[model samples]
Target: MSYENKILQMKKLLKKNNTQHVIEKEPILKPDVPNYAGIWQDAGLKMIENDFGVVFLLEKHYPLDYKHGAIYLRELYDAFGKWQQTQNAHPISLTDANNLIFYDTETTGLKGVGTHIFLNGLLEESEDGFTLKQYVLADPSNEVAFLFESKFWQGRKTIITYNGKSFDWPQLQTRWTLNKKDLPPLKEHDHLDLFHGSKRIWKNDIARMKLTQVEEEKLGFTRLDDVPGYLAPIIYLDAVKSGQPDALLKVLQHNEWDLLSLLTLYVQATNLLCEGIAEESATTYTNIGKWYADLREIDRSEELLQQVTNQYTREEAVNAYYHLGFQQKKQQNYIEARKSFQQALPYLQGRQQIIALIELAKIFEHRDKNYEFALEMTKQALKLVTESSLWTKESKTLRLADIQKRKNRLERKK
Candidate 1:
């Protein structure tokens, strides 16, 4: 069936199933009228028209006292500005508060041409604090109108969202293409996907990295009486079909909260990044140290890893010490690197222990020129592999053979 025909069929099914509970008991609005000013006004929303078509919008201003989590909204905005400056990639020009847009969308389903974006929520910093503007597609046919009317993609320098790069933005692009609408110049904006940053920082602490989980656990924001996003399509279909504003209101509320949470999460994550990992958990410090190391921030990485080694248990400190040793070795601090490697050996077990042994053996042989010590370390590693059940006999035999070669070479040097 044609896409338009499919949409018409879905609308028919929705209207046929609309009960009084789903539809408002008031007089029904005629479908022939393209304008929904009266209906939207009655529902506490404003209908606005652009060159594209008529779309419904609701704008709300939140005061400085509005608390998303532990931090007030104003404080969050300040932190976000600070965080943006610190980011090496996609450095945001936060000189104008209006340049940034925190965006989130509620869609009919995960993906594809059939799915439609029902709502788009955006939070921008205004002179009177923070302003949240939501564009609602009262009818699926108004999707283009809503997207065009919002103008979020045009003026913004930075667009922040949770998993939007993978899901939300792509879905919108697909819809725009299917509708043959001109794609907005979103390429001009720096898109920051909070999902990647959140996962990098909090994956060890929070197992499930969903936006809701991040809100509750990390930001300390709890949502109340909100509809799940998956059920949004059903509720939206019912509302559109029945011409009722109730379910759509709930969807708008949910979308608004999502945008607010995105702001909170972005602020929290950026604050954490800027403040350093001094107060975080041992594992967090170690993980963050590794992340910095990957980014080649050698001094900062060493400092954090050293904190883990100083305060955490041997088991907790093992990997940190290994990383610290590697960093030291890169800087040619052989003596300090040796101490770190030795500190790690006692806590390491299984494959890690074997790896540590090889590392120490290399350090002794190559750096210290201590052939006897290198041979001893290699012999010990071979003995452990022979006795332990960690490796299969064939694997152990191969390791033994490799170790034997190292031992023979070292002994000959001695």
Candidate 2:
């Protein structure tokens, strides 16, 4: 069926028989997404009626995240996969998908030096109006730990942050550690860091990889009047000192739009990724090779891999060759495996170097019975490894021991 039809079907399944559900459904048919304020109006009303606290709508003149550009869907999926084993919900059918926390913090200093955590602004939803909780540093010992230390972050598993992976995660980890508190095992949580992720995808056209640019260009998000982040410290300080909450409100709104922009980004990225791999000639050939290899369909894998051999990059060519080598090895085709490994050896370096070396060693030792050469390769592997790797030390130790035993047997025969 058509893509829109699939979306409609998924929407139908997810559509709840409630006012909020109907409201959410109405927007899907719109010609274009309404402005940021329009979204706040609808979501805010529901929040207010349910006694959710007032949604702080802050606007920032500068982009929230200046690093990282647009990200590809597949790249995001891979990153998310590293953190989470599975998604809570499928891409199109997002019903019952737990809400995400789109968070950003404006700190006293960017260097992360010293013990100066000046302010943390968080925009979250409640049954009442939407709430923007600003943790202020009234004194040197101001602890914003309670905001994150609570069970609020426990239930939900997905965290969508602009540059959380690099800046926010480390800072928060340090803060939690300082408090002698346990963080909520966020490594297992699906973290979508838009900064690096976006950079990977949109590094070509988007000159500035800032959140503000993506908001304006991609999501059509704009704020008429907003305070810049450079002035956030001043604004927040004044609001705290004189009991003037208006200046602080603008910062809150800036954070609030950040939260919404993150959501829109998720929606957009998911839509793009869910469209499946791009069908360009080169991309199609590479993906077909990937798909078949993943499924262990060696014949089909080899066919596609060969087709894409000269067309794609060296990395893709290496990957395809490795899989072909693996399939041939499994079939006891040692000569073919060696040929494939030779093709792949040019691309092997660093971590991949050790892996390819070990594989070649195994072929010599187990299949070819070239114990002397195998022992040399294993020694090379041992020399290259400095830390824990995908292959365990115990496994390497056993392999080395076995190779030693083989060498002894060969020596006895000699």
Candidate 3:
């Protein structure tokens, strides 16, 4: 079947399967299945009630020095403070831990309106440790009560997540929009999605950037017998249909690990951004330096990239020098930019080499008023492009035309 058609059927099943205000499935489990409220409470989930419906809630607290998967939860505080000072101390009050929400959600499906979050895991800090609250949608009918009573995020100042900026939070907003009544605005707050930072630091090193993979490979955390996320939809649906939540326990554990990982990854990421963060590989420095440059943290960017150029490998130095030069050129630091481009020349070839030559040529021509040097650089790039086999037929034609024009202009001025 087409993907869209399957989604339509799934939506129907989700809406129809809820026994309240919808058609019901014949009980999938034997009559011996424990009562829903009884099972949940026995499993450490409290029965939470509101005007809309009933939801299940579970809370666990961890002391400051408690280590989960190689990270101490308390270290995040200092890391955030350093970053806050860099942002001019924007009063986030992260030390309070009440200000930040380490959040994640487990959904019924990956996309579309059919997706409903069955579990919402939020972790915050207290005086000594961290508190995690997992809100459970006991049934589809209880979604409103679950979302509303999972405390509505009244005073939190920041929302931290793995990919919540693009997925989880947006999904929440969509749920609010669809439900469309008596809901607190899924309130706006400062957001630091660690997924982006993880990519900035580990894009080249990690084969996959999934949160679990990142924590395992980069943060030295591993889960033994952890439930895979893909099973969440099926497990949740079965529990709801069969009135059996035994399997859902593993799912909850999976989510708990996710929340803790976000907390640790954020600290490491901030540490990297602020104080070089534990001697990362040269490529990490190169990538994050370029990221900082893009964020206009030029000095910090230069500091990281500087480490890369001083490293032993020529292959490593090429990307670092190119980006450092580009950032410097953007700031009109022409001399430094020229030095960076020249330093990259020994390690570059093909398009990157030609591009660097052209950039240097432009700086000499316009900034230094050295027409002869400009013409020389342009001539070298033109010759290289003319004989290069890298470009496609159409691209080669375009390159030759542009380079010839540049060479002609430089020759006339020289």
For each candidate in turn, the TM-score is: 0.80, 0.43, 0.81
Instruction: Give the per-residue lDDT digits (tens) of candidate 3, residues 154-245.
Output: 76477888888899988887777776565666666788777877887777878899988888887789999999999998999998887777
lDDT of 1 by residue, 153-265 (tens): 56636788889999988877777666543436434467888888778777577879988898888788888898988889998777777777778899899888888888777
* Winner of 1 and 3 under lDDT: 3
Return whichever of 1 and 2 wins on lDDT. Answer: 1
- Candidate 2 residue-wise lDDT, 1-414, digit = tens: 999999998787666545355443222111222123243344331111111112222322223232223433223334344225433233222322345455677655555445345445554433322344544443233343333332344665556688888886667666656644323443345666877645543444467878888777665667658778678777755654564566666766676667666655765544433333343334344444555455565565566666656566766567667766777788889988877776887786666667676788778777787767666666666666644355578886775576456445545533
Clashing pairs in 3: none
How much does candidate 3 score in TM-score?
Answer: 0.81
Candidate 2: minimum summed lDDT over ten consecutive residues — where?
45-54
Clashing pairs in 1: none
Q: Tally clashing residue pairs in candidate 2.
A: 17
Stretches of candidate 3 off by over 4 Å are 1-34, 84-96, 182-185, 330-335, 363-380, 383-398, 409-414
- Taken over the whole model, the C-alpha lDDT of each candidate is 0.77, 0.55, 0.81
Model 1, C-alpha of 408: deviation from truth (Å) = 4.1
